[model samples]
Target: MALDFYTNPMSRGQIVRWMLEESGLPYEEKIVAYGPEMKGENYRQINPMGKVPAIVHEGRIVTECAAICVYLAEMAQEADLAPHPDERADYYRWIFFAAGPVEAAVTTRAMGFSPQPDQEVMAGFGNYDLTMSVLEGALSGRDYLCGARFTAADVYVGSQVDWGLTFGTIPSRPAFDTYAARLRDRPAYKRAKARDQALIEAQNQAQGPQN
Candidate 1:
């Protein structure tokens, strides 16, 4: 069976959609609207978390945007989006870094919470500044998260940086600006953005104008 992609255009699913486009693979997308539809039993079967982005491939299910990106890249090895086995350490490292620490730090700040110094030790991200500094250091002189060449890690990390900068969740830094610029130049990224924009516009039109 072809891959089944469950997503909401306005959600983080846009990241996975970009990854799918980068993979050059055919997928059947099921748009699950933001509220009741996403929490419905049918969609819940694919992801108990009732998330916006989930994928069913070859009878197996994958959730989480980062994981989905890695899965698709590895599956479509011909696309050269995944690193070779020997070079995969950085690939896995930064991907999980974005999903874990970076995500936690940004989310906590977005929600208006900051851990105390004593609490930093207990927090997976340490603190927002520390997390951002680590990420900035990683990308400081690098073209991609794994180094010179682009990989699946960039898709996940780049999406985070792109979204972070756009929403002011992450402070804008030189490294982030340069990184996002590179990601925007990719044809696949452009295609994904255009596709999702159309979906967003259509949905808005359906909902009609608000006061």
Candidate 2:
């Protein structure tokens, strides 16, 4: 069987979809809608978390957005999106940074979490100001997360930056603005996004409250 991508376009699955398109790889996408049988017992076998963006490749299952992006990028070597051996350290650095502090901070902000000064360090994301400063510092002098050349790290980190900015969870500073613009310029990103957006809109329509 070919690689199977379990996705719900309204979710983070869009990031994985974009990475797959960039890889120029052929895979089967099985859309899983919320509140469906696919989100129940049967699908839980593939992922106990019952999440939308899981993938089964070569009989191995991968979950988590950042992990999925890195795996597919490395698997589709022809795309040359993985970082060079010498740059692997920085590659892993920014990807994990985005997945960790950046994601936590953005999510907490979106959820209306206001951290007390004393509670800042206790929170997973420290604080919004600190998180933004750290992210901005990382991108201040670099074109990409790993610098100059784009890599799988860019796809993962750029998606976070773009989404965070769009949702107002993060500031749209010059660094984030420039990086997200570069990411949006990719044809693969555009194509993948177009499909997912339509799906998301359809989902909202289907879920709309009726009189």
Candidate 3:
């Protein structure tokens, strides 16, 4: 069966779309619109969470942006987007780091919530400053998350950096600016951006302008 990608261009699905392009594999995209279309029974059957950015590959279903990126990279082993078993420590570390701490920190800050010092222990990200500081240190002098080679880890983490900077959810530091610039230079990233942009424009036109 061809890979089935469920997504909406306005959502986090763009991250997975970029990864699919990087994998160089063919996939059939099912554009699940926002609101009731995504929350309906058909889509919910594929993802109980009623989320976009799920993938069906060979009868198996995978969800979450980071998970989908990692899954596709492993499926395309020859593409060299994933590290060998021996070098996967950094791969797993940074991938989950982006998915976990980075995501939590950005969302929390964007929503105007800050954890109190006493509540830090109860928070997974501790605090936004600490989370961003650690990430900045990790990418400061590195070309990619796993050093010289750009692996699937970079795709997931790089998307976080790119989006974070673009929306001001994360601070604009020198390391982040440099890293996001490198990610944008990728052909896969560019292709995904163009495709998603077209989709967004069409969706907006269909809805017509606001009053």
Can you give the TM-score per candidate against the true fold? Answer: 0.97, 0.92, 0.98
Better of 1 and 2 by TM-score: 1
lDDT of 1 by residue, 1-211 (tens): 4799999899999999999999988999999997788888988999989888999998999999988998898899889998887768989989999999999999999999989999998997899999999999989988997788989899999999999999999888999999999999999999999999999999999999899
* Residue pairs that clash (backbone atoms under 3 angstroms), model 3: none
What range of 10 consecutive residues in model 2 has the weakest lDDT sum?
A: 30-39
The runs of at least 3 residues in candidate 3 whose Cα sits more than 4 Å from the true structure, single-residue gaps closed, are none
Which segments of candidate 2 are over 4 A away from where they belong?
36-38, 201-211
Report RMSD (Å) for each prediction in the order shown.
Answer: 0.9, 1.9, 0.9
In the range 1-211, model 3's lDDT, one tens digit per residue, is 4799999998999999999999998999899988898999999999999998999998999999998998899899778898877769989998999989899988888888989999988897899999999999989888988888899888899998899889888889999999999999999999999999999999999999899
- Which prediction has the highest lDDT against the true structure? 1
lDDT of 2 by residue, 1-211 (tens): 3799999987889889999899888999989877755669888988888787999998999999999999998898989999898889999998999899888888777888868999987877788898899989988888888879888898888888888888787797998898899899999999999988898888879879777
